[model samples]
Structures are given as structure tokens and as C-alpha cells.
Target: MTISIAETAETIDTPVLPTTETAKPANVKEVLAFLVSQYPLCFAQDEHIKPLKVGIFQDIAQRLGDDSQISKTQLRQALRVYTSSWRYLDATKEGVSRVDIDGQPAEVIDAQQAEHAAKLLAESKQKAAEKRKARMQEQRAKQPVKAPVAPSDKKRPNKTLVKGSKPVKAAPKAVVPAAKETIATVAPALLTLEPAMLAVGNKVLVKLGQTPMPATIQEVSLPDVTVQLGSGMVIKTRQDSLYQA
Candidate 1:
């Protein structure tokens, strides 16, 4: 096929830069999702998301090229969301291989990288917890105050006359209802868990690094028991690690 002079001139023209600065975050999520669909082996959603190889951004830009529908800025932003995710950080353990854009294994995550990821995950979780607690406190504060409930009336003692020169009535006294007493129950100092005796929701003290922690059973399936610690972290452990609490 013969090409016209105008066609050749048009092909030689400079390419326009992608306009992604004005792109919204929702668009970035859509872009990330598209990437996930294109490379399911490399990317995922929720807790299944995996850690990516270092400098995967350049690899993606190089592969997608200028012809790709999404802009480089949007791709970079989407990558930021993916690699910095909680699941990604959690999965970035030492000795675990980081996957390339095609899901092929690349470099193994090192000790420093794993530790850094762990620290980030912890800080993120702590921030989330603080936000939730703050919201709960704000909600409680907004709630209307309830009126105080009056104490229920009780029967007065039978009147008895005092012996004197003449009949004298006993002195009248004010009577107020006593407050209800709540008895505190302490857990057993040391009690081992038996398969037959343990059930879901049972409170147990599990030693973590030589320190006994109070936890409540969330699930019970034979040898493994899932417990929620006082700090609200849930973990699975064997029956031997638990004691009555």
C-alpha cells in the first residue's frame, strides 16, 4: 500500500501526553481493578492480594506503552494503592518471593523489608482501631440523656406502741431502697482445657511470650481454638496453650 505525504506527516507528529492529573480516585480504583482482571495470577482483591516485585511500576508502564488506555499517572497511583494495601503488607514476609506483573516470582522479600511491612500493618491497624473508638465515643456523646429511674417503694415495718404512762407511738424514720450489690467472680488460677469441657465463647488465659493474656474463645474445633485477646486480636492456638480464666 502507498502512503500519502499527509499520512506520513501525521505519523511523524509528536504524541500527546496523557491527562491523568485531574483523574478522580474512583477512576484509579477502576484502573487497578482492570489490572487485576488482566493479571489475576499477579493481583487480587481483599486478603488474597499479594506483594508485588520492586519497581513493578516501570515494568507495567513499559508493557502498557503509550497505546494503553490508562495514563501513566493513573497506573502509578493504582500501583501505590495495590502495594501499600494491608493484605499486601501482611503477605510480604521474609523468604516469600515477590511476584512480577505476570505473577512470575521475582526477588524474595528480605528481613528488613518484612519487618518494615509488619510495622506499617501494625500502625494502620492501630489507627483504624482508634478511629472506630473515636466514632463510638462521638455517637455515645450525641445520644440523648435518659432520665434517672426512681427507686421502687418498699413495705414499711409494722407499727409497735411504746410502753409509757400512756400509749406512745414509735418515732417515724425515713427508709431508702438499698442499691443492688454485684458480686465479682474470679476465674480459676490454673485450669487446663479438656476437649469435652471447652466450647465457643469460653474465656481462657493463653501464655504469649511468657505473659498470660485474657482471651475469649471465638471458635472451637478439636485441637485448634480461635481466641480473641483482650487487645481484640484473634488468633488460633492449640488447647494446650489455653487455661481457664
Candidate 2:
């Protein structure tokens, strides 16, 4: 009978493996990249499955310092193993049903569009400044000259106008067109003046006489309401001043 090496190895059964306490870090960047690349990719839908809410993806990328340099596929492989042990890195769908940024869903705004809008606003302001400067210079050029003073007026305390010489024309006052009155047929909303009313609940549409103006109710005072006509402006109005639709 042969003393088999297999029988000896079987007799010396290995002791049970020790329990693991430490866990590996999940490469969140890789996980996000994989999710983004998935088909029918809706930010709201994909975010629901990520361990970290899609909200935290940017923060993680910033911490990583250069997620763009790393290959997404490689990251997915690493995260697959890393998240296997770490549970928080596990994906779920609790927060992915909607697509609104303020809402629960993960929605991304267009940075390029925002940048373009800012550039346009800056250019518009510069043009307006140029127009204002041109108008001021034009007015300065039109001022009238004073006529020669009479010898008799020199003796008097006040500089009296000469009778024979043509009187110096007074500079004409610049007339500004009056602001069109914002009269409306619709009545303003009767919002309760409280802390809750301060919140941007909703914008009220107005039919000011025959003119329709878009304004959001900003501040609610006792008898007056403030309307925001966009462009970071407010128009204070009395309770009986206008109507809302």
C-alpha cells in the first residue's frame, strides 16, 4: 500500500480562515463614469442606482483631483471589486425617479449656455454705457453763450439783463418720457403677509389695463406688494394699485 501525499494533506485540514475587519475604498469616479456611459442614460434614472447620490459625484471628482485622466472602464473594474465589500458604495434607486436639479433627481445645467448668457449681458451693459456717454457729450455741446454785460448793470448788486442786446438763451431742460402707468383690470392676489409668503411661491400674470406684464410677487407688506419684473428689479405696489390674473 502506497503512503499517498494526497491522504497526508487531507488529514492536515487547514484551520478556518480569519474574519476580515478592514475594507477597500470604492473608486466613485469609475462608478459614475460607468453609469453615465450606460444606455438610455437619464441622469435622474442613473443617479438612483449610484451608492453616492449623483449630487456627490462632482465632489468626489474634485477630491480625486483628475478623474478625467483616469480610464472609465478601468475604474468600473476597480469599483466592482471595491464596492463588493464596502456597502455604502452599493447602488440603489431611491433618488433617481425625477430630473429636476432642485428636485430629488440628478439634473445637470448647461454651463456653456450660462457662460454665453453672461457674455451677452456684459456686452449689453457696455453698449448702454457708451450710449449714455454719447448723450451726455451731445448735451454739453449744445449749451448757449452769455451776452456782453451793460455798463449800468456793473454798478448794481445783481447782474441785470441788457435791454438792447439779445438775452442769452436758457439751456433747455432735458425732458424724460413719463413711465407708462401700470394700470391693470385683474386684481392682485390676496397673499397673507407672513414669512411663508416671502418664499417665491409663484409668479402672478398681470393684465395691466390692456398691457400684459410678467411679474413675480416678491415681498408681501401689510397694504402693498412688491413685484419682481425679472432682471434683479422690484416694483413696490399698493394693495389697491393693480390687478393680477
Which candidate leads the pack in TM-score? 1
lDDT string for model 2 (42-159, tens) is: 3212224323333343433454455344444444443343222212222332332323222344433345533543454455456656877998999988987689986674455345
In model 1, the worst 10-residue window by lDDT is 5-14
Question: What would the per-residue lDDT of candidate 1 be over residues 29-107, giving only the tens digit for each residue?
Answer: 5666667766788877755666798898888889878878778877876676566666677789999998898899999
TM-scores of the models, in the order given = 0.52, 0.18
Clashing pairs in 2: 48-92, 183-209, 184-209, 186-243, 186-244, 187-243, 187-244
